[model samples]
Target: MKKIIEGKIWTAVCVALTLLMIVSAIWIGMRYYVSMDIYQTPSMFLEGEYSVDGGEWKSIEKDRYITDHFHKIVFKGKMSKKLLMYFGSLTISSKNVWYTLKTSDGTVIQSYNFDDEKLSYEHTQTDKPLALDMPNTPGYCVKTIYPDYLTKTENITEDSDLIFEVEYPYSYALVSYNDCVDVTAYYNEGMYLRFFYDALPPVLLFVLICFFGLFFFPVASFILGKIDYKYLTFGMLSFLWGLYMIMQQISGYLNLWIVDPTVCMMMDKITGYCFVAAVLFYFKANMSSRGTRIAANIASAAYLSCVFTVFILHLCHIRDLNASSMTMNFATAGSIVIMIVLLCVEMRINRNALFFLLSWVPLLLTVAIDAVDQFIHLPGSHYFNYGLAITMIVQIVRLIGDLRLQYKEAIRHQQMQKELYEAKVSVMTSQIRPHFMYNALTSIAMMCEIDPKIAKEATITFAKYLRGNMDSLKQTGPVPFTQELEHLKKYLYIEKLRFDDLLNIEYDIQATDFVLPLLSVQPLVENAVKHGVGMKEDGGTVRISTRETETAYEVVIEDDGVGFDINEQKDDGRSHVGMENTKKRLHDMCGGEVKIESVVGKGTTVIVILPKEGQPNEDTLS
Candidate 1:
């Protein structure tokens, strides 16, 4: 059970099941509450006729731009019995106007208004579209109140003509009247409930993404104590994008609960601008090339400058913020182009760039499609929200992959460090054997009275040899061959004092400018003196030599004493751990190798080979 809990496959299965449950729940809710009988017809306004200020009547278009809000608009249309039977209510929704419903002969029905006073328009056609001053409250937002029991209304007949007297009296609003209007026909109460329910899942997904971006990632980074700027910027990108997407999905319903509708509009605008800036910041943070980072920085600065300029102009009453929509669109499009180009260039060199491109391109394309749909007043499908969900999933997967790589690398680094430390400890202990120390010190003490001059020399050499063994413990890597040779000579000098003429020493020097693991060669020389020569009655010569090959530098230690069979394992209760550690270190540190050749009653030979710079070790190559 513990192993299953710890396994990655189990975690993946849990996540998949959780996601499936969430999706199934949403689907069940949607299928249960939403009515299939709900349908839409072409807006009734398309068949009506409108007269501006009692002037000539013109056929109403699918969409109308009303530039002359100072005049009254009288819209005339007829209600059919079939239309009234199917739809329980009709909503004439708009942010720019308030209207009264009346019969064609001019009998009043109902009036929708927050205040009775006429609105004052401060500017005319001379200035850009202006934001008029209005009460900063939810009451100021236009509310739709369709008549109850419309099919049974007393004033209505099967072919009764209705008149809509519209006025923009609260403000000098100049905009596409159709942009904010929705002439939706509700069949039943279920339609209203379904309208909000349809948006619930997308809103929930975006909110979850926002929570992770604004709180989870940043807090995790802080706790880890490694401040990765890329994750920070990614979090910012996620937050702004998520907020923007959420607003796009449900900002209309949000107005009903907010203090000020205009504040929501401003927040929406700011989120859009900041979302673009976040993308550039995330790109800059992730870039490895200085040129790419600089490019992203400059692009971000330019985009921010445009956003600030638009806001400044809006605040100064030079222009309304909505009037600069074209400029904002161009800026957003330009940033998209730049990002696509950068990603294309980076994809050739960076593997992660492909993932980034995959995540971003679909979002860009879906947003463009949704933007076009909104601009044309098409029914909302909001494919961009799906794109956002995909982007979030991809980014999460990418982060997990990076973390896995980091974990593996950290484990590998620790393992290598452990092996290196153990190698150093093994070589140190082998060099400072208690028996060799006792014999050398005993020889020195006996010689102190027999020959004081020789005794003093041997004492200093012994001290130096002991110092070398201690120093080897501190070394983490290979040392120069000359340094190892000097340390080895100190050990040999002390050994000669103990084993007088019985132990012979020889040196064949040809190469001295190479490096090997610290104390590497000295251990083999000690093995020769102790195991090969000292066991014989007539102690023989232990020869140390170095020579340069075409591709390597070699150190050879040979002893002309009783040599044991190379294939035979000695069972003298002795562990040859030092030999194994030396071989391991040689291969790990410098790709070097060790070879031994011995025959019973003959001499033994040990060779160490280290590759030359820029040359592959022959042992590794084979």
Candidate 2:
């Protein structure tokens, strides 16, 4: 047990280290190729005066910016000469707000207008394009101050007071920067290439993880059997979480599609809610205690209900999704806290719970940081993305260890079953050999007194029949039907010498193209002649026949002799070893079965049915 645990841990560490090294190598390569030598500086309007709702102007403080809904705030600042000397273009970047750039003479140079009549909330309308100069990433807008555009179009010069009117529905932060290149020049300088490298690697990693979780892991779990449910639930959680991460980077960095900000925002929130619910479901599936599972169930349902309510609110224009984000985060955090407490309880009994704690703790911290970041407006923070990578890596490593253990267990179980089956077959062969030898030798002794020539032939046949039965002791599996039939013919040839005219044998063979257990059918025929026919004063005939059916091949042994009740218990209390052993070996070797139909006054019929599925079809009887 100690060695197994050590091996699992070693494997997990190696895999985790390899994954980290791959990511690090890709990042280093990207950094080497994408140069960060771009010319840029902070704007002169870093300190500005602002007015809220057309009220009196107040001086702006560091890291303190205007934030409100459906309110107009104007910022007034002067463009410096140093910015003009460098032909420096001013860039203003903000999210979830609509504003226009204007000169001191109140001439609007560029406008990104949001129709206030369309929405009761502060979000820009998603029904149509917000404006001509829309950013590819949702909620992100950039306005560049081009040197040529200012002088040619607006005829503005250095130290000009720039009047900015802004209305914020949702605001992150409004920041200004002076750069050497204009908006066109910035894109031409391969800004997209830098963002692609920054975002695509993690997306590719998460996608691969999703493929394993959704497909590979579940297949492994099915083969393992006992741990199937938990693997499926965890797989669902991983897939949904990976999808959420992919969607986060889709429009922002990859820019695969030009999507509305509101649409992207909703998608981000929806996938987040789904994966969180999946997390709760995963806990429920993994929990050993019934009480913990019930608790997890309730938590998952409530979380999904909260998400539904938030969506309803957004759809009805009662409340926006952004307004409910913090509330939802708290709900998610509460579920995580309860799950952690449950994991603590489980860790007391199960060592695997310790591994779960290790994976989840970093995620809990990430969720806490994200809640705080949402409130404080942290710029370009991907704490959740980083934390998710760590958690997924740990969980995947643990899963690989689990699957490896299961494969070993399955192989061990199969070997044990095979050994047990062989032991049973050996015991069955031993039982038939002694009983048949006694009967054949007794018949041969009786025939020697009657005729020397006939007795000599019977002796040779008896010797061959005994040889066949002895050979079966060494046999492991099924033999061709023809082989067993030849042995049966030799047994009957000896029996015919003893019974003479009293015993009559008939054969009606239709099909002889399949395999069955060695020594399986012969015993049934022996019982029919000895017990069924020889019991009467003048013995009756025994007919042996073989035929094919749609689903199986059958050998029938029918005797027109006095039969006994099949349902009655024998007086001796000793079982018929030949019949019972033949039944077992037939079923075990070829998925075949025996059906006995006997009437006390009439006769008996024993049918051996071998299903065609597993039986070999070869070596047709000559």
Candidate 3:
């Protein structure tokens, strides 16, 4: 027991320390390579090549300086009509502002103006060519952070000097290309598949891995027997959370028309709220306390009501999509507190809850911290996904362990029922033959006239033998070796009176610390005398020996008489029933086995092997 406890502690420490090292390493490396790998090239724009508002042209390395305003960048460029002249891979949407391009001679080539309400695309407000089929809503440009991201390519007819301008209400706009390089040439120029590496966001990757990892628990549970409710609840919760993460990183959908952006945002809100409800229900599923679970259900219903109200209001244009997140985050914080209290209440009343609580407490605390972070507003708070992903991994591993242990316990319970039934059947199988009973009664009746004292002794012995055999029906588990030996002596005494000088009995008991199933070994002795020695006119000796080795206890029952072939098939009515019953009883009640060796016209040897170190349990002993 101590060894098992120590092993668990060591395993937990090793896993915790290992995860700490991995997360630390990844966080440090990601800090260096997150946005730099895609844009840090020799072809990047130089400081003196462009100017804003006719001032000195200074290079902008960071993405936060250009927020909520208009800036016109005038740069000198000598471009041949044969090469493509364009600037694309911008991460901003076109709703807040638009961009236009014109040459030094004031001839406008292309312009997109979704930001201005006064001008329409069909109305030639500016002397410029319009991009084809621009959406009324701002079309989101492709995310240049991903390798497969697509962008708009604008061609200039004859532009030696280009004036580039951005009018947006945001601080950051990722500029992937500022020169005349096409997507095909850019993909081949750099390190092989460098854009692919840039596409791999660490948090999104973890979320995807968790989506598959959380599903393994229910699969394992299903194989064990029935799937658990907690597994279903937690699995769905994890899937929805992963979906929320994926939707957050998706860049351009307005241009793609796969689904409306409004619908996508609505789905995000719906899934997020559903995940919150599922988490509360997950705890409620495992809860043993009726009052606590009921309270949790009410809390869950109330939270869901709030979420649904917000969702409906947002869909009806009563509230925008981003506005509901604050309300939901606050509600999530309230739900977390409610659960914390309920968990404590449950832990105090139910000891079985310790297993769930020990690992779950930290995860809940992390969730609470995350919920608060949404309102508190911390720098680099975008990386909260790291903590969430790690917690989910730990929770899944712990849940699997708990479910497997529960499965084993259920199997053990079923085995006990079977062992008890086998014990009862074994007692019935070891019943003394009716012929022996009639012969013993006849001898006792005859002895009463010849010797009254001998007759009384024989009657008492016969009564003891009958009582012992019947008493065995009530004993479903193992008995003491001493008690079993007394029953054996009573049966032998009755048999000896019938076979006066023909039958011989011997006993050798070398071990007595362990226990065996009631009537287990006695049946083997009965089988030996009835089928082996009793078959001969001059009955042979029956020997019963008990001994022990370092790891197991042994009982050998031997008879010197005409023995039947062990390989032969057993008939319907036979003496082999006792031996077969004993074998099954020994195996089912304890971790033991029986081996029978015999030869035709020779002798039979039956050995019962029981483990020495095995302590009898409820089913193994009374």
Listed in order, each prediction's TM-score against the native is 0.62, 0.55, 0.47
TM-score of predicted model 3?
0.47
Q: Which of the numbered candidates is closest to the native, going by highest TM-score?
A: 1
Candidate 2, which ten residues in sequence have the lowest lDDT sum? 176-185
Worst lDDT 10-window in candidate 1: 119-128
Candidate 2 local lDDT, 45-109, one digit each (tens): 42467676777887755443333222466768755554554544555443445666677788876
Question: Over the stretch 1-622, how does candidate 1's per-residue lDDT look in tens digits?
Answer: 2243236434544654576569568867887976655744234532478777678887765534433333367778766555566666564544435667777777766555435332211112332123333332112233343444544664575577788776654343333444344455566553345455666677776776676677545654543346778778877877887788887666555444443444445556777788878877887776666677777778878889999998887566575455566788789789767866776777767877776777776677788887666446445455777776676677767765765565455556557768878877887787777987888889999999999999999988888888888877778777778898999898888888888998999999898777788888887998899888888888999999999999888999999888888888789897788888889888888789999998767789999998887344445433
Runs in model 2 with CA error above 4 Å? 1-28, 37-94, 104-107, 111-147, 163-191, 223-227, 251-256, 344-351, 369-384, 434-622
Clashing pairs in 1: none
Task: TM-score winner between 1 and 3, please give it.
Answer: 1
In candidate 3, what are the lDDT values of residues 1-622, reduced to their tens digit?
3344335445644654565567556656766765643423332221225555467755544232222112344445533222232322222223233454444566544454454443333333443232322233223331122122211223333433555454332233322122111121132233223333433354445465444436544554565567777887777767766665565444223223322334444554576677678777877776878899998888888898888788777656666444556677778878867876787789888875666666565556665575565455444433455655666667777775776587667667567757666655656544556777788898888889989999899999889878887787677667777788888887888777777787899988897777888777777887788788999878889999999898888989999888888777868475454555567777777778998898777778999899865545445544
Candidate 3 or 2, higher lDDT: 2
What TM-score should be assigned to candidate 1? 0.62
Model 2 earns a TM-score of 0.55
